[model samples]
Target: MVDTVYLIKKPAEFPIADLISDNDVLILIQDAVLRQPSISNWYACKEDVIARGIKIPDNKLLDYEDILNLIEKSNKVVVW
Candidate 1:
């Protein structure tokens, strides 16, 4: 399977979330992690969560390491 990780620093420009696929895993990082998802089974960066001092809603957050692992195991990696 292939996967893409969009290290979104701006939600308005790239709007990577809108391009998610059923087979892809979305990992929101940096400043982009603060935004909420309109879909399900998507995840945000945990470090960003702490940096922004915000609490991500349950089932919406994943740790930096986990994101790293996903990138390592995936067939592709994309940053936007």
Candidate 2:
């Protein structure tokens, strides 16, 4: 299980380097999937990506079931 799961729903101009740790998971949803940051442990919502016509790697895309599992396995969940 990861230390934390961050659910980002919007694009942010501010840097997230300090906010995320090595073991934290970043999941992009809604408009946040538009911003592609070159960071490890990054994932995007499958439905959101399909709706936006965004091309994200298969491994990085998470369905609702996968997201639920992730949240359940993680130590903490933060929605932004």
Candidate 3:
């Protein structure tokens, strides 16, 4: 399980590097998928990516169920 899960819903640079650790997870949803960051342990919402016509890699995309599973498995969750 991950220590923390970050749900990014918008496009903005908020110095997340300082808050994130190696075991933490980052999920890009909504408009945030448009700005793909070259960070490890990062995932994008499949539905959002399709809706936005974003071409994220298959391995980097997560369905709603996967997202729920990640949130449930995480120790903490932060939305941005």
Candidate 4:
């Protein structure tokens, strides 16, 4: 199977990074966008991060269009 996008809203809600497989992608939004963890495929919402004044490294931001692309790339997506 292809990778999945684990859409996380709250930082504390996620268990541990070990639970997510290397093929899985962790996408943070809302409050979770600011708190980044050391995950392999980590992506945060561009607009949400900007609204919260969070400075993320280059190429890490995922806009709405980018999100749609990610959804298309993945076999399935799960929101947490």
- The TM-score values for the models, in the order shown, are 0.76, 0.90, 0.93, 0.86
Superposed Cα deviation of residue 53, candidate 3 (Å): 0.8
**What is candidate 1's local distance difference test score?**
0.70
Give one digit per residue, the lDDT tens place, for model 1 in 8-60: 66554344455777767766777777666676656888778888898887577
lDDT tens digits, residues 1-80, model 4? 34888888997766477778888888888899868887657888999999999799868889989888888899889888
Residue range 1-80, candidate 2, lDDT tens digits: 78999898887831367888888889998999998777877999999999999798999999999999989999999888
Candidate 1 regions exceeding 4 Å error are 14-18
Better candidate number, 3 or 4, judged by lDDT: 3
TM-score-based ranking: 3, 2, 4, 1
Q: lDDT of each prediction vs. the true structure?
A: 0.70, 0.87, 0.89, 0.83
* Least well predicted 10-residue stretch by lDDT in candidate 4: 11-20
Worst 10 residues of 3 by lDDT: 11-20
Largest TM-score belongs to which candidate? 3
Which residues of candidate 4, in runs, are more than 4 Å off? none
* lDDT order of candidates, top first: 3, 2, 4, 1
CA error at residue 21 for candidate 3, angstroms: 0.6
Q: What TM-score does structure 3 among the candidates reach?
A: 0.93
> Model 1, poorest ten-residue lDDT window?
9-18
